[model samples]
Target chain A: MVARITFESVHAGQQLPRLDVPITASLIVAGAIATSDFSLVHHDKAHAQAAGTPDIFMNILTSNGLVQRFVHDWAGPGARIKGLKMRLGAPNFPGDAMQLSGTVTAKEVIGQDRIVEVAVSGKNRLGEHVTATVRLALP
Target chain B: MSGTEKNNWLEKVRAMVGREALPPQTAADPVNLPMIRRWCEAMGESDPKYLDGTAAPPAMLFVWTMGHFRAGPGREGGTLLGLDLVEAAGFTSVVATNVEEEYLRELRCGDVLTQRITLDAISEEKKTGLGVGHFVTYRYEFSDQKGEVVGRTLFRVLKFRPPAKTNETAARVDTDTAGVTQPLHPRPAITRDGAFFWEGLNQRKLLVRKCGSCGRLHHPPGPMCPDCNSLEWTTQQCSGRGRIHSFVVVHQPQIPGFQYPLPVALVDLEEGVRIVANLRDIAPGKVRINMPVEVEFVEVGKDFVIPAFRERQAG
Candidate 1:
């Protein structure tokens, strides 16, 4: 069984562990396969450049999943994702390293669950790539 | 002889303890335009650039792989799980709380595209009035024909079930909303060329552009067939019915000043035309996959109307 944690156990303004994830061609390819999104911008570099993009931009879907993974791994299996909102900033290219970091914003008790909101962001070697608001529900 | 004997012994031990190899997760296929175009048309996209290759819109890229899992063998090998896992775990419904996308490049026809997908995270939380729910996150990377990267998208889906006590309250709310239901709206006044389409919608029917040269059904009401560039065409009325191929309930609005808690669906009509429209008459929570629906015209404003769907009554 997974261990349970509460809202009162953690402090507000606490920063979670940072995650260093490598972005690879294979990782991008696998994401496309799973999502069934086959826009040329994700696969063809020449096409992307021709269309005025610096490089292939990472799918917003994949970035959200990455943020979720980073927080879930830290919060353990018991943490439940309630809501997440993010804005696309810089484009993520293959062969770049993405560093994900987050800070706890607030905590409160709603019904039988304890909820925590985390402000998260993903940056690459080129600087900030994406940022979002995450709400997690804990026991 | 002794050195050979030692190497053989090491090989035997390695064979006994099988190496753990990570499963292969790579997309190797072309982005089928026919499939995507069908989805765009079904979603009520009327852009000629999407059909003409003149200028493709950004959102049309989302339809690149609509129902791709069911397309062919070996294609669905990967674990492409969506927000539906919560439903399998007994959740009543799932909604998209938010979605943000950026277009790195425009996709054109004949561009072979590839995608990579991974599960980012799944977390649960309690709602003040709706009870507990889980949010699932997924990441996607898109590539084009020449093995060059293009763009990426991140999506989050929120799945939830009604609390035992809240079920009754939800049903009551649904009933109250349905009580004030109004009739289908009238069609808008369109010009000479676009008149036939509006007329068809007023009659509760779907129309497609039939190409003269290719004899294929074209959508988005184009003047010339993209395949042959022939301008000759005719309109065909189709049954205003289809199955819910895929759908999402919007808990958060994409545009400001819009209403919330709307169920939007991608319907695959019987005439082989797919369009996106708002699902009506049924309770938001009761919407399901493969739900039979019939099209109805709803007037949004003066001289403007849209096609909507209502759940077909069971036999």
Candidate 2:
């Protein structure tokens, strides 16, 4: 069962539960298409191979979207994402697995809103795939 | 890569910074009600200001200057030139990584916008999971017809060379021919300000919200009235009658659960505002500008239903 989280229930230094995600070719390409990103390497395996990559890889936009999903899933419906500063690392290729985890770094109150900061990371077999600092405002 | 070669390429790229990479280009259509209506429908934004034609949503900072899908305005020359130089330098693949926007002014209908793009920064060569490449950042400045800056955005992208696979054998690429289903109709992004529209649809009643103060009727319902800025409003049942003020046919990027060459219409409702919906029960070619269409609720999924339109003969 999915547990609901609230600002009152959250504290600094709390660890978020890990989420496992399966990377697939369709997910990589669909994310690229949905964002109107037409870079050949994102969808064309042949082009990717010729350019030197072993296969098509995920784009940063897809990674950003995944991070949003991860944070929202844990924060519950009332949480509002204010900002995300993320950096990509290892490539997420098809047939691989990505595990995401995060920790609450800080919580503050400002003008009737509770603001929380989360330091999140996603990793695969190759190592850390993405690292990010996400900020959210909750009532 | 040799040291001298790298230096030469770096110099060429460095020249792009601090210069207007994209020239100011005028918007094809000044901010208008029809386009705003379409944008709100697609984004599921029912903000009353956007519907009543008083002010446009601030989130639409980039929409004012975006050209058509394939044949619209070209990217700024300097930015394009810099990209060409980078591509020539062996970074052949590119993907946008991040966007940060700051809106300064509320754009309204009839406001003509122009944009200028400046190359902000270019990172040094970096090696990681996605081969080697440089990160390029461009700052877009959007201004009004009066040359007043209204908004700005920082867009960053990575251009890299694909890294060669070490041991994995080549695999077949996935394509639509693999019997990929059409995309399901996208769920509306509901918020507190616009929940009533969906509720009205559930009862099969076309509801238009009217301001308690000004009595102005607006579609894409929201809590506040744009005319009077009143928080009080009431819902009125519409005749479900409207005419196609504009239409478009989508053909490519087939999503699952939707027919290709989908016909979407922007109907000017009898209530005096406009709404957008799919034109059903008619072929794409038969849909004409200014044709009369009426509302029809479609059960797209088990718990999801949305209003679609059907053609009607002139009385």
The CAPRI-style docking tier of model 1 reads incorrect
Best by TM-score: 2
TM-score of chain A of each: 0.89, 0.94
lDDT of 1: 0.60
Query: Which ten-residue region of model 1 chain A has the weakest summed lDDT?
Result: A47-56
Q: Which ten residues in a row have the lowest lDDT in candidate 2 chain A?
A: A30-39
Candidate 2: residue A32 lDDT (0-100):
62
lDDT of 2: 0.74
**Please, what are the lDDT tens digits per residue for candidate 1 over residues B1-315?**
276653454344334332221132344444545644553333233445555564343443444543353646655543335333345455544444445444456667666656666566666344522245666666656667676766555666555664443222222211125453121222222445566676677565677777777888766666668888888888888777788998988985243213458889998888887788888877788999889998888755333457889998644
The DockQ scores of all candidates, in the order shown, are 0.08, 0.04
What are the per-residue Cα lDDT tens digits for candidate 2 across A52-128?
55578887756766675677667865566666667676678887789999999999887776889899899975567
Docking class of 2: incorrect
- lDDT (tens digit, per residue) of candidate 1 on A9-106: 77788888888878776666555444455666566766554443334556654565567666765676456666566765545667578888999999
Candidate 1 residue runs with Cα over 4 Å from true position: A1-5, B1-315
